[model samples]
Target: MILTAFLTAAVLVASGGTATAAAPGTVAASDREVQFVSDGVPAYGTLHVPAHRAGARVPAALLIPGSGPTNRDGDEPPTVTPGTLKLLANALDQDGVATLRFDKYGTGRTGLGGLDPAALDLPTFTRQAVAAEQTLAKQPEVDRDEVSIVGHSEGGLQAMLVARRVRVKSLVLLAPQDLRLLDLLKIQLDAQVTAADQTALSKVITDFRAGRELDYTGMSTQLATFLQQAIFSPVNTRFVRSDDAVYPPSVARPGPRVLLTCGTQDTQVPCWTTSPLAAALRTLPRPLPVDHFQHAPGTRVNDQVLDPSVVTALRTFLEHR
Candidate 1:
């Protein structure tokens, strides 16, 4: 768990007031502040629609952010301000695609809605994604039939789940994780700890699976803190359990066209690791159309700036879809 597309048309929606117009000579997308209620939480986001010939309904995408308290712009501020989603939204706008990017419960203006963050579960976020998709599809300016889900990192996992629940034009997975959640965590943690500490990490996972409280005894402060924040904490327990239960390869089902992208420099979700997902998709009962886009050298998943190759590849994928 780490955390983060386009078209043109009449850009109005019932969830918000009129869409804002782009200034003269600027290739800015028409932006509108939009809202949707998910599980009684009023989620806030921005709808970006590219300027196109009047009366033309363009293809659209629902931008789902990655893990953690990432905002609608795919940033965890004060330190992490990648703005990955925002830049992708702008890129999609240039490609004549509309997008809806929203702040999840714990981030930005959403602010957890008086709910306890410790009690948050994966279903809460899944419901939000589904609701956002519904909202985007219902927009008068979006071609619902041509709508897609462009998910990055953990969002790619969420996108797979969303695709099973709702029909979409395609699935765009950016540096998505292909391994089971806990397994991936083990790999990440192993890289940081000594062989002895790795044993402790394994025990921690075992204790978690056994429904016992994680024992951080004898662990390094750094590893313990990371476990507390990202894994063993009550705040993420429910979500972690739910996420771990999901095997990514199992969800690569037939239905939507799939575009899986990976950056060679992404140490988190390596390009080679995506093979399981691709192989699963290939083995589906029905043949599924899938495209793989490998980024140029030096493109890492955590790039503060969007990689141009990714933008171009994504635009081409959506354009052909």
Candidate 2:
């Protein structure tokens, strides 16, 4: 189900701590618990301000997590513990940049928030991120005009959506899916099947995307099951249609400074696949230079410890602006 969910639609979607400390190096940062109501759901998150810069306004970012049920920390838990977003927040905090990361409708303390999980869709998630962005900008310690959005994997797509409706100084996409959801899935499924099977899978995807009734004949058991659970299920129908309607390249506008990164070892969104995105960004309104980092080695589907070089690149990119 996890793999099917990722292949079908992709999942997209900080606080402060500390008052006064005796020693300067004793504290990292404070996790200021924050909240915002989105679509009538009270979302929860943390605001992280560096220990040294707790009282001063600082350039900040709203961190959006990837995939399903991921929390503010960027961990899906028990089964996945990359801690990607939390590590990012820590790095940004240490660099004196405040961050806000939250749990979406289905995850963490914000679970469902009394809404039916089946009714969740991308627009609501975008609303949540937008609200978080506004909340971050309003922070006393955050420089509103200097705010940015950093989204990983599916969250990168969400970042683009949020930026369309809000103001952000920059966008950092980490291992984001570069192709449209179905296109990426076609390539992914093609890799595991024969030519005939690929053709059949393509037909199935085409029919589904066109809103035609699906004929699952000739599909492998795995593909049929995946289609049923990930794409055909009523719980996923609305979300898949909404997400598929978006093509990231078309949404890549010329406003904000953009930085895109893809990991060499990341099977989901490989470096080569992001060339289209990189190209789109290069042709932006003013055609400014886009900082593309696609050579981080040893980065996996999830990194328990984020690559130091990647972390450095992110800091340099955000700080450069």
The backbone clash count of each candidate, in order, is 7, 13
Give the distance in Å from residue 198's predicted Cα in candidate 2 to where it truly belongs: 1.5
lDDT (Cα, 0-100) at 285 in candidate 1: 19
Model 2 stretches astray by more than 4 angstroms: 1-28, 53-55, 283-303
TM-score of model 1 vs. true structure: 0.85
Candidate 2 structure, TM-score to reference: 0.85
lDDT of 1 by residue, 94-126 (tens): 788899998887788777777776666666677
Error of 2 at 80 (Å): 1.7
lDDT (0 to 1) per candidate: 0.74, 0.72
lDDT (tens digit, per residue) of candidate 2 on 85-116: 88888888767788888877677877776676
